[model samples]
Every structure is written in structure tokens, then in C-alpha cells.
Target chain A: MSEPESDSISKGKDGLTIHTVSKDRLLEFMKDMKERGFNHLSLITGVDRRDYVEVVYHLHAMDRDEYVVVKTTTDNGVVPSMTSLWNSARWDEREQYDLMGIKFEGHENLKRIFLPENWVGHPLRKDYDLSNVQYINMDEDGEDYATFDQGDGW
Target chain B: MNNFVELNFGPQHPSTHGVLRLRAKLDGEIVRELEPIIGYLHRNAEKLCELTFYADNLIFFDRMDYVASMLMESGYLEAAEKILNIPPPERVLWIRVIMNELSRIASHLVWAGAFGLDLGMLTPFFYCFAQRDYILDVFTEVCGSRQETNYMSVGGVYQDLTPEMIEHIDAFLQSFPKKLEEIYRLFVKNDIFISRNKGIGVLSKETAIDYGVTGPMLRASGVNYDVRKANPYLVYDKVDFDVPISQKGDNLARFLVRFEEMRQSVRIIKQAITKIPDGPFFNPKAKKSMMIRLRGDGEYYARTESPKGEFGVYIVGDGGVKPYRVRVRSPSFKNLSVLPVLAKDQMISDLISISGTIDLVFGEVDR
Candidate 1:
């Protein structure tokens, strides 16, 4: 895929530029940023938009004093991962996978990061069924997350 | 290079600090490679954020970095306010600062205790706990919870502090410095302490920045970057305190940063307590209809310099009762990235010392 013009990108609130990149040019863009000294990939978080997936990479440039939020869209079935470029992306991808059912394609090791390995559905998805979900004991008081009904059922 | 042996450090071990295990590849006494295995204490904090309303999310935020829960609560509230376009009142901001600094002191006390225990010193841990117990009493009086205060909310703090609570804080603030001095006098110049920590686990400035290290760990590497001062969240811009930095970039440098940071935190608390005005704690006039309404349909990133480092809350609000999506940029996770590289050639015994210096709370790491 051909690289889009620079004007296509928009600036984020925290001074990060939001670039819409295709899967083919994503690696090239990441490499360009790394060469420009965005050596630290601060965070990789996913958002589920029902019809599509939005993967945001919070990258920081220590030498240049800049940060950019690189975002890419994927179809519901295809959640492209950036673990190959940044090792720290591994955990974030696993977290995205565990909660939003987004698969980190090139992750060397990806599993349920914060939830049980056998959880039925992505709990963060809009259509997640809470009624049938089993409770997770989180604290010393044995607070089961499943039993506590989210009053609005959203 | 005859063989490489595998060593398993526990999910239950004392030094692991609350359900964190690492399977290390060892070549004699030197570590060949290290794989951190987490999730024993994972509570799915982000998922829980999606399931509940924003107001109720404060309680869960407290659990993220339970040792410094007040900071996490503040981060969440700050992010929520950004989305709602609401600035907390001056009194609320002062209260938030007071609670946050106290939490920092409390967290450092525990860290000092645990770090000493890991380094084979028992007395410091006891001394730290005694000091921490008194601080927890102050926390419990204000928020009704000792460890996890959950005192922060969207528009402001949960409630106004009583005069008695202010008196208690005043007394604690006065005595805390003396107790800190006593601890410092006991261990700061101790020959054995210096030998164990100084020149151990030396992380260079270049590598520290490359690994995205923050908080005391990064400050110790001579980085003057502090989110509170550099970015100035809440009322930190108005507060007068020094950002302590060390050029040594060793375990001792990290240790010294924590010590100095505690003193600075106390200084901040003193100013906030003395200057805080008698006004409405929360913006009681935040139109009743606006309580559940999320005003914006965009994303906001709210980052705060917690005791542990940069605790950030990234939220995508969709003008709904619940946040569209919530992502926590936990400092521990970022700090842990530098571990394998840091541990590449260090002796096995130095591993715990290095780990303790970084102060990775598993709750935040695994969240």
C-alpha cells in the first residue's frame, strides 16, 4: 500500500499525531518513528467499536521530547499486533485480547493476560453476557465480580 | 559454558512482593535470561471500568496500586474531569494533594521496609511499619479506609476534611520528619547498607530513557523529568518542591531518590494543609443532571506522577453513562520492560536488590 500524505494525520490532545496507516505500511511507519527516536512504546491499548477495532500505540521520543498516538483500524476479525516492533507490546496485546477479543497477530506469546485462560467471551465487548459469566475472586474479602449486577446491564 | 540452570522465584516468596514469579535462566551465579510470569493478582481493572459507572470506578482504581491507592484514585478523577470539562475546586485540589503526598510517604515506608528485608536488614522494616501505621490512621480517618482511600471523585474529593482530621495531619506531619531522620541516621550512612546498594544494578541515563523508565528510577539516572513538575497536573504547578535527581544511576541512586522524594512529599503536604481554604469540598452545584452525563465524545489522557511514577488514565468517552474504553498506563509495566536488559549480566543475588529499587508493584504490573 502507498503511504498516505502527511496532512492526512491529525494532532492529538497530548501533542501526539494520529496517523491512519494501512497494515502494509504500518511496519514502515513504526521503523521511521524508531529511527526518529521514539524508542519507547509507552502503551498499546485497544478499543472495540462494535464493527471495527481501534489499536492505539502511545509512543514517546525521549531525545526529541515528543509523543505520538499512532492508530490503525482493523476489521472485527483481524486485530493486528505490534509486538514484533516493541517487545512491551506483548502484554498490552494480550490485555487487548483478553478484554476485547482483539488478536495480536505477530505476538510471540499471547494469552489471557488479566482474566482466566478459559473465559468464554471478551468481557469488554459491548455484547458481553454478564449473567452467565463466572465470578472472579479479586480481593481478600472474596469479592466475586460476576455476582455483582451492573444495575444498567450495560 | 557447560550448562544453563533454571531458577524459579515464587509467586509466594517474600521479595516477589504480592504474587509475582520469575523463572530465571542462570549460568552459575550470573543470570542468563529472565522471564517474568505474572497474573496471580490480576483483577481485570480495565474490564471492571467498562462494567460500572465512572463514579463507582474510583473504588476499583484504589486497588490498582493499593500501596499508593490515593494516587491511582487521583489519576482516575483527573481523567474523568478532563472528559467532563470540570475543574475541581481549590479546596478539593488541596485535599487531593494532601492525601496523595501522605500516600507517597506511606508507600515509601513499605518500600524501605521491604527493600531492607530483601537486603538482609530486619530492623528498618520494623521501623518503617511503625511509621506507616500512624500514617494509615490518618488515611482511615479521612476516607474510612486505611490502605485504599478512594477519596477522589470527578468534580472533587468525597467530602470536606474535619478540623480534627486536619489537626491529626498536622501532628503527623510534624513528627514524620523526625521519624524519617531517625531512620536515615540509622541506615543512610551504615557501611553495610552502602556496600550492598552502591554501585549495584547500574542503569545508565541513555538506557533508562530508552526503556521509558519514570519516577525515582528515572530521576536517579539524572533525568529532571517529573510529570508533576514537567507536566504539572492538578495543583502541582502552584506547589513549591524540588525534583530530586541523582547522576550515579545505581541502586543507591534510586534509593536516595525515594528518600528525598518522601521529604519533598512531606513538604508538599505541609503547604497544602496550611493553605487549604474552608470552602465546599466538592462542587456541590455540579448540576444534578450532569452527574451521570459524560460531556465529551473524544479521548483524553490524564497522567500524574504517583509515588511509583507516571500513573496515567487513558479514556475514550462516548457520551454515555460508562466510559467507552479505559486504559491504564501502569508505570510498573513500563519499568519491568527494562528488567531483562538490566539483569542480562548481573549476579543472581543482585536481582532482588535491583527489583526492589525499581519498586514494581505486581498489582499495577498485572492490572
Candidate 2:
């Protein structure tokens, strides 16, 4: 984790190191990082790059103060879930899937978190439809569901 | 018939602070499992930050952790300033330290009062609020608003502390600790409080680290990682303060850790107020309009010791007035993730005791 041994890793001027891993290697790289004492999975987020979504991981070493970013882009919106290495990734990955529409391959509950399960396209995508109006209402089971029909309105 | 009864704790209950909903499975009076269902207050905050100008984004954070608005503003500003690469003068840094410490105390005071209410002790809530009123007065004098104090700006604070404001803070500092001592004697030493909180909902150190718990929750579990002590952003390294920790990893341990933290915050403020120098508050180069149209092309993650765990702002700037992407690493979100593990096999009444110590603030949790 100290020296950037491969071309995927680059250090920023502000001492922030960003390592780009392929989607297939994310879980393996994360397992190695956790073993090396980068046990804190600080954050997991995604950015819409128009053609693909780039997933970012902010990892921290608890014993020492080393913060590093591990990134991988997914054109098909699929990345191996790292819940095996750190359970903290569960909710964070759910958030990314909810907002940026990234798919975590092995996530047990890979469902929308913030928005309802029946909502339209992911809202954080760059070209997400803003003009389309949707509504939320409670069902007989007392669960909130999303709908597009005007009858679901107030 | 089902062996376990299904119950919904809240999206609107007094004990469960600010709109958090938990689905719990109960067998008789024991909680078998609990799943926290959040997003009752999710208002698309992160998405809005992307659309907002750098100048206007600070206020948006005010509503996130409203009880500790100053700390939230400071957390975001710490990241924004790093991206801008324009550190304010020496006086402003000290000012930030003082205000941040006071904010921490104020935030903890609110928690103390609410915790008392959760335990059905009404008198301590009033005493805690009375002490908190004094802290809010100082914030109102320094900034214009008490709860949503948009005092912090990029590169500097909006205004300097006047002499009258300084006197008010001094008076508050001199008398507040005595009142805090009264609160400690009333609650911490009370046999009933101990019986209610002791050894309830134990979260092991391994589980805490696995869930990325930070702030008092992490410290209470014996992991000593305070952003101030570890990273020393601002004048933290210059000022001397202790990071209080507990090894018990239980509800009472979290309570004791936070109580000790408030005392340490007082220590930090007392030193910062004396050491603060006279200088221009803002960096002259960072103008209002210039900040609005700022096109800083870089990314930085600023972690601040917020009242809640490791509150962070991860900013990605792309040569534009608005940030390309902004994500908040909210501590409550992570802290709440540990509920099922902790609440397993606990009594139903202990739910209040456990969540009270977990210190759920749904504004941050849902945002």
C-alpha cells in the first residue's frame, strides 16, 4: 500500500493517493488493503461520467493516518461487492446503486435505499429525467411506493 | 401465529430523535432483531450541492445536523478551503477552533437534554437546556442565527467576534462548567441511570471498526481516532486537548465518553480564546464573487471532528463554478448501521437506552 507499484496508482499533490483498479479486481484489492491495516472503509460513492459510472472508495488505516482512494469504472454498471471485507460497504453500495444505478454483483439486499423500490431511473445520473414527475404513497401494507400515474397524486 | 411480533419504532416518536424509523422483531419483551429504515428526511441534499455555487452550498449543510450547525459548516468549509488552497489568517483558525469547540459542547448539551427525556427524567432536560441557551446566545452574537448559523464561509468566517461577544463567551465559560458538574452529579452518579444504561446493547470494538463508526461511538469502543488528534486540521495540533475513550463498548460507556468529551472541549476553548491573535479574518485574495465562480480543478476529502463521528466532505472540482461531484461521509449513517448487531436479544425498553447513547440525529442520518 505504501509504494504505487503499478500504473493504476497515482499520488496527488496534496498527498492523496488514488489507485485505479479494474472492476473485476476491486474485491481482491480491497481484501489485501484491509489485511494491510487499511481496515476503515470510510466512504463508497459513484460519479456519472456520461458513458460510464466511476465508483470511488475512500479507505483509511485506523492504526495510522493514511487515507487512500481506490477507484474503478463500470460501463455495465456492475462491480463486485466488498461486503465480505468490510460490512460498512453494504449500505454505501446500496446508496450508490440507489443514486448512480451501479450494480453490486454479490450484494444480498441490492435494493434502492433513499428512493422507493418502484421509482423511475436513478436520480443522480447526468441525464436523469428531470421533467418526468413521480409521486410517493403508502400501500395497504404501509410501505411507501413510487408511481407515475396522476391518480397517485395528492 | 408468528413467534415474533412485528413493530415499527418510529418515523415520528419522541425517544427516537428526528424522524428515524426502525423495524423491530420482538418475542415477548425481548428484541430479537432490529432493522433501521431511514430516508424520512432525505431531501436530495448531495444532488443539490452539485447544482449549487460554492458560495451557497455551506448553508445547505446547516439543515443536515441542525443541532450542531457550526460544526457542519466548519466540516464542509474545511474541505472547500483545501480545494481552494487559500487558508485564512491565523486569527480565523483560532476563531474556528473556539467556535467549533463551543458548537461541540452545545451539540452534546442538546443530546444530554434529549437523553434525559428519553429516560423519562424531565428536570435534567431543563437544566441542560438552560446551559445550552447560553451557548446559543454566543452563537447568535457572533453569527445572526442560533440554530442555522451560517457563520463560516470559505477562506474565513463572515465576521470577527466583537469585544462584547468575547465577554459573553467568557461569562458563559466561567459559569457553565459548574452547571455541567451539577448535571453530572444528578445523572451520571444516579443509581437509576446506571441500572438503566449499564452493559446494555454492547457493540464490540471489532464490529464498530467494521461498521466505520467514528466520534464518541468509536472512542467509546476503544478506538482512539479523532480527526482533530489524528489529522490536526486547523489549529488542533497547536492547542492541547485530550481524546477521551472507554473500553466497555456499551451504552454507559458511550455516555461517559461524550460527557468527558464535553469537558475536553471546554479545555480547548479556554486555551483558544486566550491564544487568538488580531488579524484579518478573511484572505484578501478570496473575494465573494471570485469564490462564487471558483473553478478549482481538484478533489479533497476534509474530515472534521463533528459532534457525530467522522463527518467528512468529499469534493471533486472540475474547473467550474459548481463542483462536479460532492458526497458527504455522514457518521450517523454508518453508526446506525450497527443497530441490528447491538439490539439483538436486548429487552424492548433497552432500545431507548441503546439508541439514546448511539445518539441518532436523523437530519445527518437521512441526508
Candidate 3:
């Protein structure tokens, strides 16, 4: 297999080569990288850049001992999931959805991960209101679970 | 055929280890599908670090993998140093290796004892803890804290190791092997232990990699991918030791892999202590200021082989006192992801054994 399109690739701040693929081409780019022996998808995280949410993929090629960072930006917070390509991306994508509000298309379970189901806003977003916090009532029943209150519990 | 019962294993049980709830779908005695419900111990570590100054967040790194705080601190500090382009002196690196290896042994001791307890053997728990206390004494003598030793700083470690600290470690190392043997004979050679663990929760080499399992769990599956050996950070490459691997991919295999790893850590500590050079522990330049500000926008990921697996830190600097973004790629988080796969089709009793072998520390997992 040939390398990812040269236009999609650039050097990152740490001197590791970073591939900034479009949201649509991410799965294909990841598959190609996996085929090229970048077998380990070490980390998957999202950074809320205000203008657009940036999803970062840290892939490690164990054979050649090379590290590559693949990042893609999404304005609408919808990006194709790489869970099909890498099993480790499953929880990571869910976490991104939970904390950064970056929706992963084709994710098997795209529900809230760390936060309670009743959480209103993604906490990691740059514009996330720290003052507009909600506390869950743990004593509530399962049917009435996580009743959000405007109290300063935390 | 449609009679599948859903069993909630734990959010409070002892075997689950630290507030982990597994919703297991069972067909009679065998589990069909197991989903791990985490986040009970979540403290939003990544988000919390972003709010704190670079130096101030080092203590929180200790809380991530509380069992092996030194290794976690080392990984975070290394990432910070990478972004700042600061290299710690040779003595600091060797001292870190000694501390990190001691932490490794301590972490593995906890795992060993817990694993034995999970397998219904109580004696090994006491044996392992006794040895672990000695290692903690060494940490206390050096860093002033036993478990949460926030000893590592951005440019270097917090304090220099004293002669008394070295002597304590030396004494521990001398007595550790015999204690380890007793535990080994009790757990490894025992027929009941083998019957409980061997060939149970067999995760194939391909499956382990596919699930991104690391450290002892991956090595137990016959993979030779160790962060210490693969990507050498700190003074790990300079230290001569073998990464023990087993092809069984079963509970027994994972147990043996970690059991051998404790010995390897001892070996590394011995060599690191003997070869530790006399020099400055922390970088003199960084010591001038309590707060460190990176000059430019940069991002770097640095990983160290923690006792559990590969503990990594990815930092994004916006040329500020505090990091723009800090993402911790905790090994337990990824390692715990494989539980559903490993637990599938296994007996309900064997689930405890499988989870024990994986060595799930909920602090890192839920982070």
C-alpha cells in the first residue's frame, strides 16, 4: 500500500510526523496506516479548538518504532469512527463524545461515558460554562436518576 | 435458548477492585457478554491538569496510578521536559530509574497479593504486602511519602536520594528474592492456583494487540512490545534486563509475566544503584523559578513503562504557564477495555481471575 496523501501529512511540534486528514478521509487514512504497519492506535482524544473540534489519534508502528499523530478537525462535531479499524478506539470515541461533544459516526455505543446521562454540556469544550454546573442526586431512584440541580455541590 | 440472565457483578464488591461494575449477560454458568461500567473513580484528571500550572499538576499525576506513583510522575515529567526541551542530569535519570523500579515492584506486589486473593489463596496476600512495605519504606525515606510520592518535577525529581534511602532499598532488594520465592511457591507452584488460572481467559496474541493491551497482559500473550524496550525513555535502555514473556495468553501466563517482572525490576534497581553517578539531581536552570512557561506552541507525547503497562502523557503547549491541553493515555484505561473480550464465554468464577490478571487500578482506568 502507498503512503497517505502527502497533502494530508505534516510535521507536528514534537518532530513526529502528523497527518491532518479531512474528516471524511480519516478512516481510509487510518486503514492505510494500519496496513503500513502502524498497528497500534495508542491514544484517541479530542481538543475543543473553539472554531472546530480537533480529534487526535496517536498511532505507533511497533515494527519500525515510529510514532505518528493524526488529527482531523470537524466544525459540526461529526467525524467517522475508527472503532472498526482499531478496537481501542471504541471507548476513546465515546469519551470524546462525552467530554468534547465530538460525535463519532458509526460508533457502536455513542452514549455519554464519564459524565452522567443527564449532563447538559460537554465539559472539555473551551466555551464550557464552569458556573453553569449541575449536580446529580445520587439518592434518586433509577427511573428518576441523576436529577440535575443548580446547587453548588462540587 | 432465549433465557439469558443479566448479572451485575460489582460496583461495590471486593473482587472487582475499586468501584468497577461489570454488567455480565449470563447463560447458566457462562458469561455471554460483559460490559464494564466505569467512571466511578473519575476525577477528570485531564481537565483538572489543564487548569493547574505545569509544576503544580505533578502531584495529581501521582493520584492517576496511585499504586505506581513514581512511574506516573516520571511519565508526566518526561512529557513536560520534552515540550520544554529540558534534559535532566544523569544522576536524576538514574535516581528516577531506581525509584520507578521500586514502584514497579510495589505495584506488582499489590497485584500478586490481589491476584492470589482473587484465586482464593489468602496467605500470598500477607506475604506480598510484607515485601511491599519494605519498598514503601524506601520511598518514605527518599520522598517523604509512601504511596503518593510526588517526587518528580518538570526538569528533574523533587529531592536527592540520601545514603540512608539507598541502604533501605539495598536491604529490601537483598530480602525481596526470598520473600518472592515463598509467594511464588505458594501461588505459582500450587495445584489449586494453577487449576483456577491456567488456560482461563485465554486472550490470543492477535486479540491482545487488536484490543491495545500493554505491559504484562500483552507480554503474557507472547508479544514483545514493552515501552521500556520499544521506546526507551529515561535510563531504561541503559539498564540491562529482559522483558519476560509467556505464550499462554491465559490467567496463569499473565500472573507469571508480572511475577517475573518484579524480579526484573529488582535487577534494574540493583544496577541503577551501583552505577548512580554523583551529580545534581534537578536542573539548576529550572530551579530558579517555581513556575515553568514553555516559550512556543508545541505538542509532545512521552510514554514510560509503568508497572501496569505503558503510561503516556500528551501535552499541548500554547506558550503559556499552564498547558493548553493535557491528555493522559493511561494503560489501565486501555487494558480494562479488553475485559469484555476476555471475559466472554468464560465461567462466572473465572471472571474474577481474568480481571485480577489484568491488574485493573480504577484510578487510572476511570481517569
Candidate 4:
């Protein structure tokens, strides 16, 4: 699994090595990366590309203090989860799913972390309607519910 | 029939600290499974940063780690400056080190004091807060704010330190170590505190690395991975200091690591003062007007060792005044992700101790 991914490897202007891999091979590639001492999963972010969503993973080797950015593009906004490799991915993936609308396949509990379940649309998306303000109200069970009508809230 | 009691730890409880909610399933006093439900304070900070110019995001960055606003501002500025390719003058570099260290110490004071209150130690809370106010006074003198000081800019600082301000800082630096020693004795030597914290919430090195827990938490596990020492930035290469660590990896170890870090900050500030040179602090090219219209096309992640951990700001610019995307690698968010691992098989009371050791800042976590 640790073979030279020469075709996918490219250097960004930021001076970090980047590996651009397909969605299906991402998990295996990451598994190989973890084996090669990229033990620390620094941060995971998803950016809207208008047509397709690009997911970025910043990995670091603690002993060597080296870093690499792993990137994958998904037209459907679904990528394999790294939760199996790193426990911290569970929350980071959830955040991406919550805001950027990128779904992590095979995640344990992929739920909205920063917004209510009834939230209208992913706020980070470029097409997200920011003018339509959503308010929250707590019911008898103390669970928050998102509402579009202002009167229905607090 | 199962006797698992479901509990809501906090959306409002004092110990949970600042709108963080932990949904836990408890079998008597032992936690079975826990889910941390956040977003009460999520104001779409990342999304907001994407919409505004890079310079405009400084205030928003300050809000994320309000306790250590200067550190947040500095980290964000570092990344933005990298893309803009603005290397500040030597004097600005030394000033950055001084301000960043003071911010680290102030943040640790808040964490130490609030942590003591969680364990019902009230006197330390007042002592630590009173000590923290002096640091805030220095900040107020610099930027006229007690907490959220908008002092840092992209290439340099908004204002240079006056002579009176430097004397104030020197006086505080001279007197603060003895005060920190007093705070240390109050928490470290007490038998009750030791019994509560020692051997509790032991985070192994592998687990700490896997979860990306940086700063004192990782150091507590004997991982010598400080961003300052590992990849020195902004004159950190010039400063002399030790990266204190312990192999115990317990709650007390984490406490000692941060407590020691406060003293080290004092040491760094002292060195920075004498080494600082006289020069223009602000880069003329990156003035306010230029920052508003500054357009860069590239991506860079600038990480700094903030008080709590390794705080990084990743900026991707698309040849526009505003950044294409801004992602914050919040230390607390990553550290808090391993809560279940730390809280597992411990008494419910120990949960507070573990969390206190972890140092949860919900603004950064939820943002």
C-alpha cells in the first residue's frame, strides 16, 4: 500500500507535499500514510468547489515534524471515513458534514454537530441562503428545534 | 432490565463551562457512553471568515479563543501574512513573542483558576483571576481592551509599545514568578488535590498522537512536540527555553505541564525584552488600506503553540481580496474529541477532573 504515488504527488505553493487521490483509494492511501509515521491527524476540512466538493486532510508526523496535505474530490460530496484509522476523525468529519455538507461514508454517528437536525441547508455551501434566518426553540424535552418563523422562537 | 441512567452534563451547568453539553449514559457513577453536543455558540465563524477580507477576520478569530485573544489573532495573522508574503521587521518579531507568551500565561491562569473552582477550591480561583487581571491591564494599555485585544495585524502590530508599557511589562515579569509559585503550591502540594488528580485520566502517547492532542496535554504524555521547539517561528529559534514534559500522562501531569509553561512564558518574555531592537513595527505595504484590498493566490497553514495547544489557521486565497476558504484547526476541538477515551471507566466525579485537565474552550470547539 505504500508504493510511490508519483502521479498524484504534487507540491503546493505553501511548500507542503500534497497527495491527490481518488475517493475509493483514500482509505487505503491514508492507511499507508499512517504506517509511514504520519501518526497525527491534524485537521480535516471540506471546501465547496461549485461543481464538486474537495476534502482536505492535514497530516503530521510527530517525531519528524513533517506535514502532508491529502486531498480528494467528490462530485457527490461523499468520501470514505478515516474514523477507523483515527478516532479524532469522528468529530472532525461530523463538523464537515454539518457545515460543508460533505458526507463521510461508514462513519459511526454522522450527525449535525453545530446545528439542530432540522436545520434547512448546509450554511457553508456557496448557494446557502443566508437571508433566510433560522431561529431555535427548546421544547418540553429541552431539545432544540430550528424554525424559520421568528414568532415560533424564543 | 438495564439500569443505565441517561444524563445531560451541561448546556448551562457551571462545571461544563460555557455552553458545552455532554450527553452521558451512566451506570450508577461510572460513565458508559458519552456524546458531546456542541453548536450553541457556533456563529458560523469559518463561513464568516470566508465572506470577509483576511484582515477583517482578526476580531472573529479573537472571539474563538476569547481567553487568549492575542494568540488567536497572532496565529491567523501568521497564515495570512504567509500568503501575502509579508516578512515583518525584527522588532515586530520580538514584540510578537512577548505578546504571545503573555497571552499564553493569561489563558493558563484562566484555565487554572476555573479548573480549581470545578474541584471546589475557591481561593485559588480568586488568586489566579487577580493575577490574570494584571496581564489584562498590560493588554488594555496596548489595545484598550481587557480580554479581546485587537493588537496584531497581518504584517505587524496596530501600535508599537510605548516606553511606559515596556516598563509595566518588565515590572510584571519581575513580580509574576513568585505569584505563580504561590498558585502552584496551592494546587500541587495539597493532599486532597493530589488524590483527586493523580493517576486519573491517563492519556497514553499513542492515543494523544492519534487524536492530535497538542500543547501541554501531549507533553504530559512525554511527547516532546512543541511547535515552538519543533518548527520555530517568529524568533522562537532565538529564545532559550525548555519544553517541560512528563511520562505520567495523568491529570496532575497535564496540570504540572501548563503550570510550568506559565513560568517558561515569564522566562521567554524576559529574554524578548532585552533582545528587542528599535525599528518600525508595522510594514508600510500592509497598512490598513492595503490589507483591505490585499489579494493573494495561494494556500498556507500557519500554526503557533497557543496556550492550550497547537492552534493553526489554514487560508486558501483565490486571487481575491477575500479568502476562498478559511479553516481553523482549533486545539480544544481536537483535544476534546478524545473525551470518551479519557472519561472511560472513571467515576462520574473524575469526569470533571479529566475535563478540567483537558481544558475545554467551547467557543473554539464549536466555532
DockQ of all candidates, in order? 0.39, 0.65, 0.72, 0.78
How well does candidate 4 reproduce the true complex, by DockQ?
A: 0.78
Q: Which is the better candidate, 1 or 3, if ranked by lDDT?
A: 3
Kindly report the interface RMSD of candidate 3, rounded to 1 decimal: 1.3
Name every residue pair that clashes in candidate 1. Answer: none
| Reference contacts reproduced by model 2 | 0.55
Candidate 2 lDDT (Cα, 0 to 1): 0.87
- RMSD for all candidates, in order, please: 4.7, 2.3, 1.8, 2.2
Error of 2 at B32 (Å): 1.0
lDDT of 4 by residue, B258-341 (tens): 998998899999999988999999888898778888886788988899877999988988999889999999999889888888
Cα lDDT of model 4 by residue, A15-115, tens digit: 89888999988898898888888888999989898999999999998999999999999999999999999887988899999999998999989998888
Docking class of 3: medium
lDDT of 3 by residue, B269-332 (tens): 9999899999898887677464555442589888888888888888988888888899988888
For model 1, residues B8-101, the per-residue Cα lDDT tens digits are: 9998998877787888999989998998777888777887887787777888888888899988999888788777677788888888888889
Between candidates 1 and 4, the one scoring higher on DockQ is 4
Interface root mean square deviation for model 4, in Å?
1.1
Report the C-alpha lDDT of model 2 over B237-315, residue by residue, as the tens digit.
9989899999999988998899999999989988888888998999876778778766666888888889889998988
Model 2, span A37-147: residue lDDT tens: 898899998988889888989999998879999989989999999898899999999998998899999999998888777777888888876666688888999887776
| Candidate 1, residue A35: lDDT | 72
The local lDDT score (0 to 100) that residue A97 gets in candidate 4 is: 94
